[model samples]
Target: MSGRKAELVEQVARIRDLDLRLLDRVSREALTLDRNWMVEYARWQSGNWQTMSLYNDSGDPSDVAIRDCEARETTVLEHMPATRELLRSFGLKYMWVRIARLPANTFLWEHSDYRDLADLERHRLHIPLHTNRSATLTLGGARVHLGYGSLWRLVPTNRHGACNLSGPDRLHIIMDCYADDTFRDLTSNLTLDDNDIQWLPEATDGEISAHLDEAVALGKLGYHQAAEHSLLKLFYQYSMPEGMGYDLVIRAYEMMGEHARAEQWRLEKKVKLCLA
Candidate 1:
């Protein structure tokens, strides 16, 4: 890692709250706009987690894979003037920007980002538009909610996952910005409140076995994906070593006589978590 990245990693650790002014106008406008969320990046998530790009490489909202490039505003931004203005106010070099929605019971499985991008300095920012307490981001053995009224910075290179356990959709404007002098200055100060963090404890062996049995039961009843997701959701609930949830999923598949799927998940775990 570069010196700048090393400093940033030390500052953020995993995730931190930023002391930026809130823009309620943008949040309100986001709720009223026509959201044409596209389902992409199936490998990183389970259930109804989707994205609609505002700024992307091709200026196409449907092109949602996050890549390193000079991003341009898509047609979706045309309907979101407040959001557009807010983006401009940041005065940072944006790589990609999108409106991501994670609906009820959705899960973004444990993974790291920027794994395939060039060795460049980039970071992610999140502004909550609409959300519920049940919606939380899990990383570093802690669950945190990036509540509205402030910007949240996440070092996407860390192993992490997210979930919305209950009803109602969780919406946020996510920005991937390349680091510059202005960006560094903007994030010179960050705060992580104890109240915002729920540190998870290590899952007991019995608890782990019970979850696996439940997942296996679900798989036997023809809810294979749900079964896998049930095990995957454990990452958000209790602390485990990296990729343990995926291992449980593989075990579930093996018990269900789906050896092919078991092997596939073994590979998927490595790929999604960037274990290789």
Candidate 2:
């Protein structure tokens, strides 16, 4: 498991399939509306959480960016084809989207997505629309420096923060994705939302299994780093005495030029502990 764990670390550095240009094409125009809505929502609610969220960002200089969820109505999320594709590939469900406007020389305080304390797949995703080479996000112990035309996502699963050292006002988009029951029973949760959407929680094997499947898919898609990171965050539930659960980690190791380490994990026995 330790060797596998080492492999997992390397996997996270190599994933780059998320097309920033494609996302930029959609978000450049779409950002105005989303930013406006967030501003308006912040003004009206002040402290109250809005749709698919817990609170609106006030663009406050003193405020550090955070994720928010709605009051009640939507507890579980339904998915569209495109969103489902992301969920299947990432092994998490989308709920609310968040954006933060950070001033220069500012950074968010470090924090982790508390297991079971938050919801399932409970983490944050960030994308920069406008920022210079100085914008960066520090995840786990590694600081991922962001440049134009890059896509990066991380679980609040570990402690993380952001730094805006550049001159431009850092514009970042955050989408919250959760893990839930029905979502876990199958590969992808394809139902569309007729009303409100709920974030899923990771409580049962169904949810955990779905996440593992998603991790595998992500690894296969060459988002090896993202997949391995997901697996590591889910360490408590996914790890079994059988141990081959770290197959993605092995792949990640090989990708990072750790063939010997990868071979070590490959020699371990594979085990899946079904909690029933």
Candidate 3:
């Protein structure tokens, strides 16, 4: 098995314990839902809009998507720190949650964590949360039952999809992991240096993946201009001009509460050559 794969299993086990603890502090009624993000994003694509009601089919042994829960409405990503901290008992960090509802006959489209990070790895952990009894969880092409207090891991990079068969509401609380001191020591303090230019994954559906790959290369080569240009070319509709939006990136990183890392990138500019 790959080192990343092993890391995933270990993290998942730790998170499961945390999940059990979280159920005690949380109430099935406490889970809240909102759709601001969904409506706004969907409106950008098309003017049609719908306010979705949050449902709780998670209690059902068998759940269905459309008939049980309406997915078109925006789902909220609530910050549950106590639940997040519980994962730390086993040494985990970085957490987020999304309460997903799939009415009967509804299917979650294929997706992965790859789009979430520029520095994605296959070893991260995922904790599936289903508080509803009728809710049935499926992953990696299989059906797995997770009771009210049960939690499970999902490696998104692998070919995976999900379905809810219980005619009720369900919530999927997923979290990701990174290598801690143990992993760093095992890797002998390895690092990922930059490159001059990296080609996009040809089959990436002209997605952000290619541009991100190029951006990393440009940053490594200290070619901020070219990198920004490529990003502009790829994300043409973005607010700032291409190859000149490091400030925007800095702001976003700041919003995500990653000031140190953002500052580190700014320091990378120190080595860059400036024109007279």
Give the per-residue lDDT of model 1 (tens digit) for 65-155.
8999999899887887878888888898999999888999888999988889989999898888888888888887778887877777887
- lDDT on C-alpha atoms for all candidate structures: 0.82, 0.43, 0.36
Question: Over the full model, what C-alpha lDDT does candidate 2 score relative to the true structure?
Answer: 0.43
Candidate 3 structure, TM-score to reference: 0.38
lDDT by residue (tens digit), candidate 3, 50-85:
222222224221121212121221122124354434
Q: Which candidate ranks first by TM-score, i.e. highest?
A: 1
The better-scoring model by TM-score among 2 and 3 is 2
Measured by C-alpha RMSD in angstroms, how accurate is candidate 3? 17.1
Backbone N/Cα/C clashes per model = 0, 13, 35
- Candidate 3 residue spans exceeding 4 A from truth: 1-15, 18-22, 33-91, 95-99, 122-129, 132-141, 181-276
Q: After superposition, how far is residue 211 of candidate 1 from its true place, in Å?
A: 1.5
Best by lDDT: 1
The TM-score values for the models, in the order shown, are 0.90, 0.40, 0.38
Question: Between the candidate structures 1 and 2, which one is better when assessed by TM-score?
Answer: 1
Clashing residue pairs in candidate 1, if any? none
Candidate 2: residue 164 lDDT (0-100): 59
lDDT by residue for model 2 (45-151), tens: 11222122222344221222344443111111121232223334444454555445666755443333433244445434455557765655544333455444444
